[model samples]
Target: MNENKEYFVNEEDFIVSKTDVKGRITYCNQPFLKIVGATQEQLLHKPHNIIRHPDMPR
Candidate 1:
């Protein structure tokens, strides 16, 4: 795994997404896909926690 790699959202870009009432992603824009490093098929209907990094601070 590329643990040292990081993705950043450009200042001029916007992240957009829609999740179900249970917090499962239903739709996401390109910026969201880029930041999360996932394709639409990989993220659709998936839990938001799928993007949580183990090293991320609580």
Candidate 2:
């Protein structure tokens, strides 16, 4: 193994909110709202599936 190489921490172990590989919010940390600047009410009904354009390859 390459001792000089670095490794990335797993998402669950880090504090970061990420979009899934398919670009959707699957799991969010406590700071999700502060990061996205949205309220629970704003995020409730708005999963990425809503605003997705038909042209998207997915």
| Model 1 ranges off by over 4 Å | 1-12, 56-58
- State the weakest 10-residue window (summed lDDT) of model 2: 43-52
Could you estimate the TM-score for every candidate?
Answer: 0.67, 0.33
Instruction: List runs of model 2 lying over 4 Å from the truth.
Output: 1-29, 49-58
**Cα RMSD, each candidate:** 12.1, 6.4
Give model 2's TM-score versus the native structure: 0.33
Q: Rate the local accuracy (lDDT) of all candidates.
A: 0.86, 0.56
Instruction: Give me candidate 1's TM-score against the actual structure.
Output: 0.67
Model 2 Cα shift for residue 41 (angstroms): 0.3
Which one is best on lDDT? 1
* Residue 19 displacement (Å), model 1: 0.6
